[model samples]
Target chain A: MEVVKKYSETELVQLLQQRSGNVFSYLYDNYSGALYSVILNVVNEEELANDVLQEVFVKIWKQIDSYDSSKGRLFTWMLNIARNASIDMVRSKGFQNSRQNRELSEDVYSAGGTSETKTDQIGLRKVVYSLKEEYRVLVELSYFQGYTQDEIAKMLNIPLGTVKTRLRTALIQLREIIKP
Target chain B: MDIKAYIESGVIESYVLGMAESQEAAELEQLSRQYPEIKQAIDEFEAALEKQSLAAAIAPPAGVKEALFSSLESEFKKDRSQGQVASINWGRYLAAASVILLVVSSALNIYFYNQFKSTSTAYQSLLAEKNTLIAENQNTQTKVLDLYNSMQMMSDPTVIKISMTGIAGKENNLATVFWDSKSKDVYLLPNKLPDAGANKQYQLWAIVDGKPVDAGVMGTCAGLCKMKNIPNASMFAITLEKKGGSATPTMDQMYVAGKVG
Candidate 1:
């Protein structure tokens, strides 16, 4: 459904405060496909993908008030929510292992220019792709999987200070790459 | 804190990405107000993350948009349909009512006190008259004893007791057929059963072997009810049947069952 209509952040939020269909339609048009793809990638099963899709909207309804344009764009906030939910689905013991045969993270970058709409990770993959292994891994863990740098440090078997350094340099590389 | 140096340090970027600890995030959030550039930097970082994350979206089902809108209408309409009823505090109303009652009673008390001063004997005489009526009622109390005795015999425990429990996962459901085996009658201890909704009623079944035969549709009991002549059977069942009942038991919706033997 190519319903991804344009709306300013404030107008969209006001519509959401009213809980208008226009707002949810905008959400469906813009985010549903991307989130569905995200969830499908993580859970790697169609049924759970559908379930997570339903759950994502339910979360949006329940948590509409939590979104703040001052912090970031609507898509970033929603992506964070969708990612966390999909991760929860993957982590649940009920999900059989080995079902996720293909790399799910690749699907994250494959969905055309949805990420280009926001600013922070502009050419994130481009810069990240060029990053040294340490910085690249840190950027992936911190941004994609929503891991805190502290957690990334432990996962990457590095010191916390080094994580902060890698993340800083990684963002520099991303800035240079995405700088118009 | 030097805001430009701090922003250049890329700590705000880390904070925007949610990799910063609470203290660092709080500090950055605080400093972002002091310097708009830091705020702008953080906002830019947030925007970029949004763009990058947008890569994850997948097309939902064909009707998901319709489902979302319909659900939104249903959920959001509850408040709009009922227009806002600004709830009045009933407690405050009760307090005002009690104060009004207190003032009225006190005024009446004062007026009565002044009247009593004019003829004190009238108040004494009225009280004496009320005592005489009470004494007359006390003299006729013996007949009430006979009626109370009849009620005791009817409610007596020789009223048979059959044990019952709720269906598994339905702890509120209960069925007990208390038979006055001598009278071949049944009394359901409905006090134990959870309440059901309108037009919904529980039907009792007398099961012979595995088959359920209808016994009777239970009548509402404040706590207890008496039904006549329950067939002697090995087991009793309760099912959510129609307003009345089926001639035979419906096995699927049976709420509770246990054997008498």
Candidate 2:
């Protein structure tokens, strides 16, 4: 069992800015699992998610100086990076072509129960999946896939006002379910 | 303004999710600063999102962490090498420019001498001035080359940089030691130290198994001075000593000391 050291947010940020390798290791240990899950959620392919995860960490290391604590927590900032990188990987031309082909052969791949079952095994992922179908899809698209409410509205053929309301409701419900 | 309504409007949620437009996000950030309750609401939502994300957490494959660290290490090395390349290019450019200037000046000297034999004294002064400029440029080039070499040595991956800071009374004194583990070579940079004057000099010591071994005596140098190598050592210290140096370190005269990691 490894004894993990704890640092306050301010201390962590200071050490990170100083390029302390120890702090970076501590950061990776504490947050990689959460960040990896976020990337996996967006990309949906384990191999691609692994690549995006590495890219996200590299981005975080390079751009840590740009991180502003006043805007949000460190993890929230990292979560956004993870999601955006994953989304970028999925949105690339090559990825889209491959994904289209994969979808065509989805029946064969589904038999293996890869990404869906893996996500379902997690406790909170199940809770998130249990959201009302409308709310769940909205949460998945906007939160995991880095889509805006307007974009979600356009994509889902719903009104912009309705998108905002549904997303708000969906998040509020998630908050309620996950509240300890 | 209705802060409660603003908080309840889910704008904070939008911002946390990174779904908010730039203008909306900026406004919320400003509002969060102004209102404690709005900040609290944003914090609560961010906490919820963090919890949700963590709940879905999956440990990456076993070798990923090692891969990430190695990539980072290589990235750093790449950056350093790029910097060295840039500096080397600049040095070559400067040298080329100086050589061009020297050649052009020599051509002018010959052209002026051939055009006016009666103005021979003026030509002699011009020749002297050109020679002085050439010498100055050569001196500068030598200094630049030395500085570049010192930088290259200091930035070597095998070199462990140790900053030895001043002891209690000599708090302003500072120096650095770059010890190459593979070659067992030591280089010292005297960053700040009181002048030892004529009779006394600074001596470096490497502590091995609780005893001090003399590394070398300091020479007055602007750049890194090569010191004697110690195959095994735990700490390094510098002390004021007799000009030629002493077999034993003068403990009370210790200026700066730093422990090896």
Candidate 3:
């Protein structure tokens, strides 16, 4: 495994804009894994995750013009694109048909508890697990599944305001858990 | 602004996590610039989420990279091949050069022909400008002659310059009425007034023997213009009325008044 050298956001953005080979390699080495993880969490299948990751990167390369620095980080922007692509894949008729026999758990992500996760990730996962069930579900729906506050509220049969405040409390709990 | 309360509101977290609506996201972008604390809170939450994502990072299947980079290499090669065609080709350049020389000679002929035509057109315009200048000289001479006569009248003590001040709503308006009592000639010079609409006009009234008499209708409120002379009037007033003046002054529309001393 090769470690991608770190770059300032400015330098990375310039290289990405120029579509440099060196920068593309660096981006792949640094971000592809984290992006793959996000996709895997959403699709819950290694093969579909692989396909979605490839599709996401292609979309990123094609839509590089739409990326803006003022809106957020490069990684965050890429994360957003990756999350949407994965969620879209799982929502497609093909994906639903493939999984027609299995009952999809409302909190399917919690099952990753016993999977072979990274050592550092295990610590973070522990922090996530320590959060109350309500807080954890909000984090999962919002962070992993990419559900909006309104969507989360509708899905859980909760008020929109309560969903917003609960998500805030969950983040506060996360801050307390992960604080140095 | 309670920066702490704003941070605690979880809107920043929602924004960072890509859960904020379009409008709320725009506001968060603006707030980050306005408040350093909001910016810092956003940065911290982003860093925390980034860490969590990184920890769960799964090295993609090894074949995926081999697949992705090969496609990238093919794209690079395609670009290079397209660039290669654009590089100088001596044989093609020699053929193009001879054709270009022939075209260049014809283009030069057309260019010079246009230059000559435009020069003649410019010369004709200059002659027209000279004619206009001559006419303007005659017009200026007439104006100078009128000014000389007006200056002669101004120096005469018999002609009085009455200053009219604006009244009520038209407080900023002003005008001057030059009265030559010996000749009974009244000239109105408007300084400023609220612009009346196209159908409105300012009418002048002379106070003669405790009764209002029509002085004249002032049209367009332009330069020093003649008005009906009332040699025995004690005071003068201006009123806004319908276009072409009115039979009687609209008393409530009186904009300015002055008493001759």
Candidate 4:
């Protein structure tokens, strides 16, 4: 049971900029769970998700110097990296060829089921599952699946304007549901 | 710009969720700086998303972390090796330098420890000497204060100074008694008296109407020694008696006597 030292956001960024390995370890220990969940949701396979998570951290370490605090928060930046890496793995030629038979909807359903079983400890699966079907689908596509608003609009056969508003409404609803 | 309309347009949400086009995101970033409300809206959404993501976290398989760290370490090693061809030579030089440094530091440690030990010993002795000097100073101050008080008492108009000269064969023995008639307090100064040997003490006696009343025994003091108070005494005298003082004065051993003038 090693004691983990806590750092404020500013201090963490400063240490990270100084290229401290210990701060990187702290970052991984604290945020890896959430990053893994997002990665798993996108890749939908444990082995591939693991590889994506590793790649995401490596990218985070390498790109830390370029991180702009004014643009967004550290967690948000890392989340973006994780989501991008997971999406890249899923859209790769080998991954799509292997799972070509499975429908994208079935992939989403299986991803949801996998997340439900894996994240039972936190019980946040219920929160996402509890969303209205339309809002939940929009959130899963735009957020977890890393689909562009335009792509989601085309895929769901909805107007681009409708996709944008519904995605916003879904997030607002999520904010309300999770508000303390 | 209509800030409320811009907010309701869902641009801030799209920006936070990373779904906005690059052009749209760039525009939002610029506008957020100009408008605080837009910034607040973006921040609120980002916080909400972060909280939800955290609540939805799943621990990765155990060996993943170990494998990831080892790979990172190996990558670091590969980079170092690739960058430095003469690293082996540098490693040998570093090892030799560190060995010398260790020996030098150990020697310095022993030297410093010895120096500290002797310094502390000297400091302790000096501290003890200072305490002894302080005690001696206090003793001297007390003697000086006693002398000053005695001088003050003698200068008072109501105090009569009685000089008791040695009686008969003990003529060299002399003492003085300062008697304050207003307060009837008696103080004695054994000016030139022989030390009373073991098992004996010098005692003072005050005579009232020709009857000698025992005063008190006199202890050796550097300054005036206070004796028993006598309201009316015609004479004061000192005599050598038993260590605790006799009830009646030994008229034969009367060393000094003086009439109160």
Best by DockQ: 2
A59-101, model 3: which lDDT tens digit per residue?
7776777888877778888888888898889778898787764
User: RMSD in angstroms, candidate 1?
Assistant: 39.7
TM-score, candidate 4, is: 0.54
Best by TM-score: 4
How many angstroms is residue A106 displaced in model 3 relative to the true structure, after the best TM-score fit? 4.7
Give one digit per residue, the lDDT tens place, for model 2 in B117-221: 758877899999999999999988877887888999998999999999999999999999999999999999999989998899999999999999999999866
Give every collision pair in model 4.
none
Error of 3 at B179 (Å): 99
Backbone clash pairs for candidate 2 read none
Residue B203 displacement (Å), model 3: 99
lDDT by residue for model 3 over B201-261, one digit each (tens)?
A: 8888889988889999887422466789777888888999998898888999999999988
Model 1 per-residue lDDT tens digits across residues B52-129:
545434456777656656666777664444333223446667788999999999999999988878677877888999
lDDT score, residue B118, model 4?
A: 96
- What lDDT is reached at residue B206 by model 1? 73
DockQ of each candidate relative to the true complex: 0.17, 0.24, 0.22, 0.22
What is model 1's DockQ versus the real complex? 0.17
Taking all chains together, the TM-score of candidate 2 against the true structure is 0.53
Over 4 Å off, model 2 = A1-5, A101-117, A120-125, B74-261
Q: In model 1, which regions exceed 4 Å deviation?
A: A1-6, A34-50, A96-127, B51-73, B76-261
Q: What are the per-model numbers of colliding residue pairs?
A: 19, 0, 0, 0
lDDT of 3 at A54: 81
